[model samples]
Target: MPQYSIKDHLYESQLFINRSIAAAIIVTLMLLLLGVRMVYLQVVSHEHYTTLSKDNRVKLQPLPPTRGLIYDRNGVILAQNLPAYSLEITPEKVESLEQTIEQLALILPISEEDRRRFKKLRRQRRPLRQYPDPSTPER
Candidate 1:
């Protein structure tokens, strides 16, 4: 190992201190710039950013309530509720659903006409609806 004289040792220590001080100054400046930017975003432009966030979350959901029944003088259900069973699907959750539907058809009672009808109506945005049996006679 080579030994350094007193003057060389002093020069090395001064160089190390200068580099450390320069690094600390750069770090301090970066932190100050980051703080200023954060304040500008949170306070100066908060309303504009909040409105943009709201627009991204725009949504429309339909609510359909059940209708009241109609009855005659005799205690009879002129209009009654019909039990409806529905299978719901999400386009995002289902991938290659035709193959999945084929698998389901093998296990369930699904006709070609039924599949065709489902495919036609599935693209429409109408909410599912079920009506009471029309032939139900008044008592």
Candidate 2:
């Protein structure tokens, strides 16, 4: 049997209390630092981050000015402007493009000549280009 002394018990209790206090202080400091970092990002750096997020969204641009109208020798409009209707499709919105194209071919009166013309134009266009030519009426 070991004889317990008052000094030994007091020293042990003091050591345990000191370790507990150190652990509590470390945890509290970590929490405070985490809260401060969160506040900084949400409040101080919010505008910069918000702008970055907005930059990722789509941007629209207007077309440049049209060319001058051509005139004949008699000062009459020769190559005058004609009212044209244009339609555009965003590739991101289309699904199953091959199937859609096949369906379109069935619905529209696209001739064999038109398909060949499309193929020739497709070869000339950039690789990333997905939309059909705006010049084509049945596209």
Candidate 3:
């Protein structure tokens, strides 16, 4: 004959219930911690992050300084900066190049040499073309 011991049904049920309650409490605590961390980042640290973002978005560029004059050993001028005025014409914008030049000549002094150079450049290139007005005397 084989002998078997009786199982304690009430104790087993209480143990299972306790374990379920412990797991639920742990999960609830983890969710509460996550919510608090999210609130702190969005509200408390808002200004610091905003300033950092603005600093990243804006950029600063340095302008180059004007070049100085250069001279040879004999004191002869090798290179020097001269202020000169120039005229730029876009072929596409003007209805007639000859007419526009004639109109400009009436308003400003356009020499024969300037007119000749303008015609030569107009033939060689397209789009915006610039030429110096030699009417200004050399410095």
Each model's lDDT comes to: 0.67, 0.69, 0.74
TM-score of each: 0.39, 0.40, 0.42
Among all windows of 10 consecutive residues in model 3, the one with the lowest summed lDDT is 130-139
Candidate number with greatest lDDT? 3
Candidate 1: lDDT of 32?
100
* RMSD (CA, angstroms), candidate 2: 9.6
Identify the leading candidate in terms of TM-score. Answer: 3
For each of the candidates, give the backbone clash count.
0, 0, 0
Taking the tens digit of each residue's C-alpha lDDT, what string does model 1 give over 1-139? 9997566888899999999999999999999999999999999999999999998866445445488778989978898766554444544455776876777667667776677666665565444432211122212
**What is the per-residue lDDT of model 2 for residues 47-69, given as tens digits with 9 covering 90 to 100?**
99899888887455556548768
lDDT, model 3 = 0.74
Report clash pairs, candidate 2: none
Candidate 1: residue pairs that collide: none
After superposition of all CA atoms, the RMSD between model 3 and the true structure is 12.8
